[model samples]
Target chain A: MAQKVVEEAVVAVTEPAVLIHRIALLFSPGRHWLLLILASLPAFSLFATVLPEDRADVMYHRYDGGGVEVDGPSILVRKSVMDTVSLSANYYVDSISSASVDVVSTASPYTEERTETSLSMDYLHNKTLMSLALTKSDESDYLSETGSFSISHDMFGDLTTVSLGYSVGNDDISRNGDADFGDQVKRQNYRLSLSQILTKNTILGVGWETITDEGFLNNPYRSYRYLDPLAGNGYSYLPEVYPRTRTSNALALRLKYYLPYRAALSSEYRYFNDTWGVDANNFELAYTHPFKEKWIFDIRYRYYTQDGADFYSDLFTRRAPQTYLARDKELSSFQSHTLGLAMSYEIKPGFLQFVDRGTLNLAYDYIHFDYDDFRDLTRGGVVGEEPFYSFSANVIKAYVSIWY
Target chain B: MLTNHRLLPLVLLLALTGCAIEPWVQPYERARLADPIMSFERDPVANGFRHHVYQTREAARGAEGGGGGGCGCN
Candidate 1:
């Protein structure tokens, strides 16, 4: 029976991939295929299996930090057909304006826009739920396509759930002005997770994932600096280089408990390591409180720390000093802390004749990042002797959801 | 084949315990668990954005159950 279920899930996964492929081929570059899919959705709601609630969301998000500003709008729509199938589509965009430290010292500040679209479907078979998703992201210099499939099973009277997932992605990278500079990357991910209800008020979850990446993995425009006593700033910049392949593994544990006063508390921990010799740990704690019947408030704190990759260096002694060289801040030893707050207000039921419920939500987060090895070049005392880099960021999100 | 070997023990364990297992929390006692507050991911859209931000800013990625392609910015 288990084998049969797996086989069925695999079959279910392929169906959506084929459909999405055909849809992609049919639509022109500028045509709105998402609208076409939405128009044709009602025809599929003929099954009698349990499905997720139908809802639509519109969100606006903004992030500001380190002389960089990113803001955009995202929209998501999910609808169920009959009882057995659910489909979701999302459109997201990011408009970025950057004068960040790295860009300022080595390159000119610039503005860019990224757009992403995704389609997903879930098929329910008894206690098994199979999910398939396809996503495409496009920007001026990068294009990525990804597909994922997962199977989830509930057992032991629904007290335990297990999921297995896999995803494959392909990316094409290009330089903004250099038409001849082009590269590609391929990635694969495998994931496993288990959730168990320990008691009436407590639940536990564990997840493990592995990812492998191959091909070009570094930014074409970014450069690493090395000491050059005769140069203007005592250092000269050279194009950064990175390993051609990498593999990483991450394991996470999460727990949530209901408090006696109608509130919930949750915590999560994750450990991650990669073949590039980066090790990271993340911890988060959150509390959720509901006021009366219409309002919910949440507060969370997250801390993350990571060691530098083996090939990373804030400053090298000479040009091409290492077989693989990286000066990316994200690859350096660093720690970040985030504090987040969110509130949701439920709209009165039947606010509209066609809608069952609605909600308005706003969330804000403050993050502080400190780097141990990477220096702030803008400070400019000495090249490698400068102060460690640190910066703070603010993120805001506002969204409205309507359930039909 | 290697995956099958790894799953054999789990399959056996589940099969052995399937018959004897009884839900400790009765259906009537599950109201609290069903509350929206108990949801691991209360806001999917917001969570997705937050994860994207972290993935680009940090070297660590994955294991939070969300999967999408990368922009290669990292």
Candidate 2:
């Protein structure tokens, strides 16, 4: 179900937090090693660099799954000034309609829309590049603003690149019908990455990121069921509660190899862990093939698995059973498999006089997700003995790009 | 913490030595790498949308060189 669709008039009265702002965890002792690594990177080398191409893209995307439908349009444009600076802007919108299980269980089916706008500027100096970006997203009851900065330098005679980045986000949450309900969440992210050209035909990249969030971390409109023998259905619903703060870390390794012929192969592995007692792994492989001079084809497969959070459960024993409680399926143990295919065709220059190059692209993906702890309650089976839940989704993207 | 201190000198030594190492793959030999087929991310718009989809559905996020977080999806 789309989290953006919440038409309920229910009042979400958030209680006082058991803990105060834990934003200080960003500088915890455990992060010293990462800081030292960043400090020890080599100085930049004097190498010539050019700005990225000036281009514009128009894309339409759709996702259909779990009785929810979402379709959106995204437009991005970038331009270069002189030879040192590149500026870009993006406008994105998502229109959502949902009648998923979560909505059918305790809330009414709803429709909603969210829009996001972002702008960024990149400056290239010698072999070093600096970038700054700002983004804002607005929905009926939620608003978020984020700002980010990053720097990259080419070292070791252009054989290696090192980058550091940081971003912060502030968000405001409000209830639809309750004018008095308001909450805020603050988030910070730290990133470090390296890209190395191992050989003429091979490249490798590694990245690590730490993200910390403090404040309201749960869905205000969602509820969890607890066993209540006194009730007719043997259960009662209460607003879901969650920890006030969360911290997560992710590390990823990627490799791309150019085949001897006219093909490229890529593989990636990522590991993730969080303070909420969740661990995850993701693996992916992809291949790209170019035919003649005007067409390219791509195929990819991905697998992901994760363990449930410590407080996640299908059904709780009683009300206020634990300090933190959640039945959100996203926090449950699950695995997913994805298969994707894409094709792109280059447009002849004679077709468009002003544009230097153009391409039309189409892509599709099919994903299957299986949950280990979350169950399908609509089956009308015994409580705690219901069958596990699984679903499949189809995603499509069609886009056009032009370079001038 | 003491172990990190001891290892710092070794790391510094290794990085300093990098300057002396010659480029193994010459610029002329990078033709294959320059090809569009070898790009890690070919379509930025499509790739960005894919990332958003997964981030909204899964508990795992970040470490993919993406920034800006204003998604109400999750």
Candidate 3:
């Protein structure tokens, strides 16, 4: 049962890719011409703008916890090419240093860097909007390429909206230390969403997603341990094994309410289940308020819990391992909490000659995780004496955005 | 799968209720809804970064639409 859930989890994570592809394919040259023609029509002129807007954003992020540290910077730029068309590009980088328990117990800690680049285009034709995006990520031992497309339509005087999307991705996986090890994985995703304005102060949305994955799903460098009675209570490590294919589904509902005091409240609930025995739920709440005509303050909280995969175990008792086994802590039963706060200040227009609007934002979040079944392996091999795995992490983000 | 069977009815119920209770508001009376703060995503860049952080850390993904690639972090 756990194996089924694990498979589903892997597939579920890959669903976003499929929807992207579908949306991209939806906009061929003929459709683009048609949309352009529609945009120029006098009937639609009232809903379109004549001037283009340009914006740039720069962000920095840092994460520290569980003997692992990651810090990075990202930059994004967007420009409107036409009244109904816009383009955007982003570059992101991550520098990671890890001395986590798993690495210390079985392997040496190391530093690595990953970089990603992406480009996207969006088009709006009257009440219909469409988008296409492509992304590439590269590291020393891994590479991935992904494409996505999506479309949304507004109806009933713009009180309701529906969207559909698809994406696809291909990834090449390898281990730096093991030159001979190489594998690949393919992922696809499909998504549908509906949004409605319930009243002047309230809006609600619901979304459903499905994902499919094929090929290698396990970490090439990760291993699990099993006790060997013949070795006098000691344990031996073996490479983790996983199924090659998986499918999973997820559903989410979100709500936003505007308060009379100029504050906004938002909440979301998500439920996920997979073929492996895993079931998960997530709940989130947020509040945003504006003050002094220049500052916005926001606070959010999230709770997440999940069941373990069927084959996930901290220690295998048998001398011979099962055909498919894994001990990755993420596949274990766990619960986590996150609390976040953010503040953004807007600069008044005309503060700069060329810049129309500018905003500076800073945000921070603290996350805590507790594993119910997985244990910290840094301790000596003792069954009941092993401590349950738990860790806390902090994340910080600072960014500035400017529009011209 | 059985859990999905049970939740499907609830989802349908809520969706229907949302559609049924939607009140019509004239274009001139939509000032509140048009407020920047009322937008589902007021800042695309910030929201994208937030989504990436959550996707990499959590086991679940895909509530939002696509455009993210896989990394070895998971």
Runs in model 3 deviating more than 4 A are A1-54, A349-352, B1-23, B65-73
For residues A135-207, what per-residue lDDT tens digits would candidate 2 score against the true structure?
A: 8888888898889888888877677888898889898998788899899999888889888889988989899
**Candidate 3: tens digits of C-alpha lDDT, residues A1-404:** 33443343233222312222233233354545433433343433111111223678899988898888988998989887645788989998889998987888778999999898889888877667788888888989889888888888776555777888888889899999788989998988788888887886788888888877898988777787788666655777788888788677889898989899888999989998776667889999999999998899999999999998777888887644677788777778999999999999997567578786788999999999999987887765575358898999998989998876
DockQ score for model 3, please?
Answer: 0.16
Q: Model 2 in CAPRI terms: which quality?
A: acceptable
- Count of backbone clashes, every candidate in sequence: 3, 0, 27
Q: Write the per-residue lDDT of candidate 1 for residues A133-175, one digit (tens) a residue.
A: 9988999999998898988887775678888998899999999
lDDT of 2 by residue, B1-74 (tens): 56988999988998889775677864334556656666655677888899988988888988865443434445
lDDT (C-alpha) at residue A357 in model 2: 79
Q: Rank all candidate structures by their DockQ, best first, as comma-separated numbers.
A: 2, 1, 3
Where model 2 places Cα greater than 4 Å from the true spot, the runs are: A1-49, A349-351, B1-20, B66-73
Of the true interface contacts, each candidate retains a share of 0.50, 0.50, 0.22
Per-prediction TM-score: 0.86, 0.86, 0.82
Considering every candidate listed, which one attains the maximal DockQ? 2
Interface RMSD of 1: 11.9
Give the Å error, residue A203, model 1: 0.8
